[model samples]
Target: MYSWSCRFGLMMAAIFAVSSGQALAQTSAPPVKASLRLDWKGGGQHAPFYLARDRGYYKDEGIDLDIISGSGSSDVVKQVGSKAVEFGIADALVLVQAAEQRVPLTAIAAYYQRTPIVVLSPQSKPVTDPAQLTQGVKLGSKKGSATFQGLTALLAANDIPMQKVTLVDIGFGVQPLLVKQVDAMMGFSMNEPIEAESAGLPVTVMAIADHGVDAYGLMIVSNPDLIAKNPALVKGFLKATAHGLSDAAKDPAAAVAAVNNAVSESDPARETKVLDRTLPYFQSDDKEAHGAGWQSESRWEHTIAIAKKLGLVERDLSAHQVFSNDMLPH
Candidate 1:
């Protein structure tokens, strides 16, 4: 056989070759950087994005996600359509409206299964039924807001004339309601009602969905160009989001903590409560079967019908124009 020195040299060379191969195998490509715009500022509703980022779900998907706060759902749609951002979360109806206007945005997933828009009034006034909102009742809402559009749809569905209720253009903040400036306010079920109750004002909440306005809530949207060009990126982002939402549903406390950690300005307890309230909106009998981020053609048709009723769209938009569930994680 071989001399001792030759044998040792051969063994050393084999060891070096294995070590180099291991190093090469351990090397990973840098993550792809991407941005995601939210419909509103950081809150409990945004826990999934934060949770995904904090838990390395995006990292696992090869995405370096930057979650950006947005002004409103409408604004988010505009941003995504303009390609100001690669992705966004917005109201489903807003996406319908945008698509009708040929905004070039496509919804990839439905994040909230049920609409969260509501009419908040003090218990003292107690406008429980949509029909109860009679003439001379002042309702506060921001002009050109998703809430206003939803309120309009609710009134129309209830056979109530828009002129019967006086519309007050109150920007943001519950001051208009707390100060009695407006008899009722248009708000989100998980937002303003909680604030009103905390401020020692017993509030009556009339969920728009309960009042005959059945529409999808928040949805994840992206530009058609992006979806067509970089489909892998879109699929990867959606996969990470699906994982994040699944984890959030399993442990809301962990999700809330992730939000609180990312947005220190938010009160952890309040965010926790918000996350708790938001979880149900993310699920439904249908979603339970198909999984989170699921979209239905029936829901899209309903939303389009409402948009047409509200005069938000001139022509009927097909479900294909508004949303595509193909990208959702299986």
Candidate 2:
């Protein structure tokens, strides 16, 4: 038999080997760093992303996401195309325009199923029909904005002459409407109507969709090169995002709270109300059938047709060239 000391020495060596192996197994790889560019300033519409970050959903997916604000949806497209950001949220119509310009961007997921563009007017003098907008009725809109393009498309598709209504360039904000600078304004269903109501100005909202303008709204976008080289990263980010959105849909209050906590400038009460109004746009018949962020081919065709009609795109780009469902989680 071996001496006791020799047996004890062997046992000690075994213990050390086991400890080292455990330590190696416990080591974790560093989280992948990625930046997400929002279409515009942070608001209730951005709650899902903030929810994901606040709840450590992104960390669970091995991604360290940096969510940044954007000047506009069109600018977000350019930012993603130039690789300034790995991903971006932008208007799907803008993506079509960008694709036509060969900007090298593709929409991976469509977040807003219904376009939020709307025509806001006082309840007292409600212009319910598109044709009701006539020569004397001044419509305020940011020149060259998606809302303006959407308004123009709605009028054109409905056989309403553009010259019948006057288009006034009113930068951002509802001051023009509140001050009666314009009889009506082109704004978002979730944005301006809420603000108007809060200010005790009852308004009638005419959704562009109700006027025959069928188009996709906000979409998750990325460059083709990113999808080609780091598909796993793209998949992980989308999976986490879908989970966050699912949870947000279940509890919008919690999602809004997450946004309020993450963003210093955010107003919790207002954002809570904003989120309530915004969530409906995130789901539709298509989303209910497939899942959230589902992009239907027919909808894309309609969007492309609208862009073409507006002369927003110079070349004809097929729906496939502008959007891809390949990156969405199964």
lDDT of each: 0.88, 0.88
lDDT of 1 by residue, 1-330 (tens): 999999999999999999999887776668889999998898899999999999999989889999998988888988898899999999887887888789999889888888999999999888788876775678999988778988898988889888888889998778899999999999998898888887889999889998788899999999999999999899999999988888998989899999888875989888887888798898887778988788889888999999889887899779998988887778
- State how far residue 77 of model 2 sits from its true place (Å): 1.7
Quickly count the clashes in candidate 2.
Answer: 0
Worst 10 residues of 2 by lDDT: 22-31
Please give the clash total of every predicted structure, in order.
0, 0
| Clash list (residue pairs), candidate 2 | none
TM-score of each: 0.89, 0.91
Candidate 2 per-residue C-alpha lDDT over 180-271 given as tens digits, one digit per residue, 9 for 90 to 100:
99999999988888888888889998999888988998999999999999998888888889988988889888898888877779888888
Runs of candidate 2 with Cα error greater than 4 angstroms are 1-27
Each model's Cα RMSD: 2.8, 2.7
Q: List the residue pairs that clash in candidate 1.
A: none
